[model samples]
Target chain A: MANMIDLIEKSEVTGDFPKFQIGDTLRVFFKIKEGDKERVQVFEGVLIGERGGSNKRAITVRKISFSHGVERMFPLASPRIEKIEIAQTGYVRRAKLYYLRDLRGKKARIRERQDYKKGKDLSTAQVNAAK
Target chain B: MTMGIMATKLGMTQIFIEEGVRVPVTVLKMDPNFVVSKKTMEKDGYTALQLGFGQIRAKLVNKPTKGHFQKANVEPTRFLSEFRVDEKELANYEIGAQIGLEFFEGVLSLDIAGVSKGKGFAGVMKRHNFAGFPASHGTHETFRHGGSIGMRAQPGKVLKGKRMAGHMGDELVTMKNLRVIRIMAEENLILVRGAVPGSKGKVVEIKVSTRKPKALPGVGGATLEEASKNPMKASKAGAKGAGGKKK
Candidate 1:
């Protein structure tokens, strides 16, 4: 009886999603279609949290623009999302970084996490100093 | 009263179409449907086709219904619905004729009717959508009350059909003009763009919309012609195999 729902759920699976979590810096490339013309727009921000599951999973991205904090939540499985790039690794203690909204300037910064991968944004001295 | 079929609401989900737009669709699973009997003007003084759907065991069949199935020379089914058609269209169907999901192919929209979800013993706000008294301004226990029902002497008692709190839902509800998003004939599944009348797992009656859409390209320009054609006069393949391109 429920096989039809399972068939639709199977078709909606894109099958290509990288393991990126909350507190990770993300560069999302979204495809913008304006009538006949189409373009890719990039939004660089920190992924504060994620909710839902399966095809409905969404990412909440927060970025400080012009000294004003802006947060955008969108479905990660959206067809319009062209690419998702992890720009930085953040070490945090909580699942949702909503407390970052109350902090400002240097206080809003996320502590860098030293995972196995090398990041282009990290300096050689900074990487060695963490060791 | 037009051409219709019986299907059950499977559930709702989203699917990506050609334009990368995710359309919300309700999955409806219609197993093979058959024409059980025909009511004619000469016999019943009305024109309608009794369609039988859903698989049922022969042992579970009662005596009368089992006899009715035996007369039609078809297997027993659990559900039957009558679709009114013109007397002239009565000649199109014979008992034991098979109607497939392809019957809805090329149709742009449809109307569905079913029993809605039951809300037992609901309040006025939940039932009749009555605007209750203000919560503040020293309001007491009547926040969600039915409010004043009648005036004093002029009307004496409350007028008939006055909106009041009572049994809510579990009544026949029809949702009209739901867009036909896609039809998966292979799977016997039709994806409708919007919500149907009932919640999931409810048997719903699907009929051709009363309102005709503007400029929908019907396959072979045939709905009635194709449907009335003897199953052998045309290939039994689905709509895709037909000479018409998929819309």
Candidate 2:
């Protein structure tokens, strides 16, 4: 399993991905191609969960549209992703913010995480950081 | 036309093509291989080329294997495999001549042959996929049994090669017509679509298919030419000054 991750990391492309966490709100700029044309589509949502490591890493984003909850899972290393903007950071106890799905309106709101600002933005640095 | 090479199964991964289509591929590391011997119809009653792959330590080479490599003036290899090729193409190859992933260039589909992972001693249900007896309702200890072997009194013993519990896997399995998704020639790595017949690190013999790849249009000679044109030249050039190995 670890070897699989190592193999993935070797092939995964590392771009300037934004630093965000579960329960945080993000605007993911995804590249969508149309008939002989390509455009960037912005998907704003609350980060529900994140799984896998390095190249195989993926994030689940959930957003409410017309009172209906919609969730989309995006691979972090996918080339279709143009950029990700961390609009707001949310304070979360659990790694996966799946419980947010059940809550509506006021209850769904996540507290803003203040501690994240104190640390230097690590994701911005182009260094070989492995987890 | 019998184009094949010996490679080690590096593992499996997914590559995103145009339009975010994730193609699952098994990466095979094709170590440098050399033609050890060629069997001609006049000499050996067959037209085949015996290729040696992976470097083996001189001490690890047996007496017979050492003699074989000595005769060819090449280093001992870990694995030796034979593939049938056309007699006319046999002249293109020479004794001790090297081959690698280059042979697989433009090969859209390939036949992967390897020893599947051994599943030890298994029962009929797991090994043969036999639907066992009911789990509940007085079916005690007969849960995983193969049930009735044959009709009453008709044939006393079990039929030969009957699907029964025994050793499973650890056998030579060939997965044919797998699409060749990517070829990293610098690393000697080949990415083939779909699952191969072996576990990670297993030695797999990859050969060009005589049959056409299913449903894939324009997968003939042109694809192989495109693959040979060094698609990864830009990527390899970027890493040259860093003193890093491609693999």
Candidate 3:
């Protein structure tokens, strides 16, 4: 928590990442470099959990594919993360959506947040309304 | 043989690299250190450089240490350490010359010497990593204790240096071949990959490894040459100006 550590954390790439918490459906734009070629890959999933703070902060994203549950952990400060976009917000009380892994079909779906646009700004409100 | 500097442990932090690979680094603050004295073969029968680190008020220095600093014609420093090097390298440095993080700039690896965190009167389970008895049906308070001291009458007295419950840590520990991840000259911080001995704020001696890595042949001496050439230029160009003084 020293000033030097703070300075070091500030030097890392915070990029213009969308603010989305747990239970929110999000899409991450990750940059992948192969040799001299660079490309962007998009991963869409539900924000399950987030841990740590500052430069060490990481987030867990889970998505179901072919009836198999897949989870990925990504460091927020990583340079590979080009951007993040909140596709939709879901209504949930818990901070982590780990229980979603056990549920399948009808039990796994999260209800859409009704007041998502109430407190948000006009620009974000429009995006949420469009979703 | 290259000169060394004294630094303080500034806690650990993580840094993400180009490929999104996160590296855990232990930050060390190496303040501007001055050469207090040099030991020549003719005088001390060995070649070494005595360097001082950290600034202190002149009034706080004792008379003996004051006289020692007076002999070297330098300001009083809080920490002093001697680094043994070859006599040929002694001519490169003088009594009043300064050393900083620039001395570790292209250095990939180094040897760190410091006193590890003290855990006083530790038991065999914690100190020596001995597998204590498990808590089961008949296990009692002796579960955490060392099982037996001796076998039969074959060994009358306990063997010397036997693994037992005793003092742990608070000893001079040298971690060798620790990679130097990054050197922020402006912040006077050297970020090293993996952990080093000692806790935060503890003084640590950072020295170039005597055994040079085959991958980096001239890195040790080249780093020193770069530091000697620019002195405090890196600090000036970076945030912290000369002598680690924040702007």
- What digit string (tens of lDDT, one per residue) describes model 2 on residues A1-131? 23532554455544467667777788899988777799998988999899987667899999999999999998987768988877776777888887887899999998876634455323322211321
Q: In terms of TM-score, which candidate is strongest? A: 3
Model 3, position B230: C-alpha lDDT score: 36
TM-score of 1: 0.84
- Looking at model 2, the pairs that clash are B106-B223, B106-B224
DockQ (CA atoms), all models: 0.25, 0.30, 0.39
DockQ of 3: 0.39
Between candidates 1 and 2, the one scoring higher on DockQ is 2
Off by over 4 Å in 2: A1-8, A34-37, A115-117, A120-131, B155-157, B214-247
Chain A TM-scores of each predicted structure, in the order given, are: 0.80, 0.79, 0.84
List residue ranges in candidate 1 displaced over 4 A: A116-131, B212-247
Query: True interface contacts reproduced by each model, as a fraction?
Result: 0.39, 0.16, 0.45
lDDT of 2 by residue, B40-145 (tens): 9999998999999887788898899899988998899988889888999998999999997668745667898999999999999889899999989999899999
- DockQ, candidate 2, comes to 0.30
- Cα error of candidate 3 at position B48, Å: 1.0
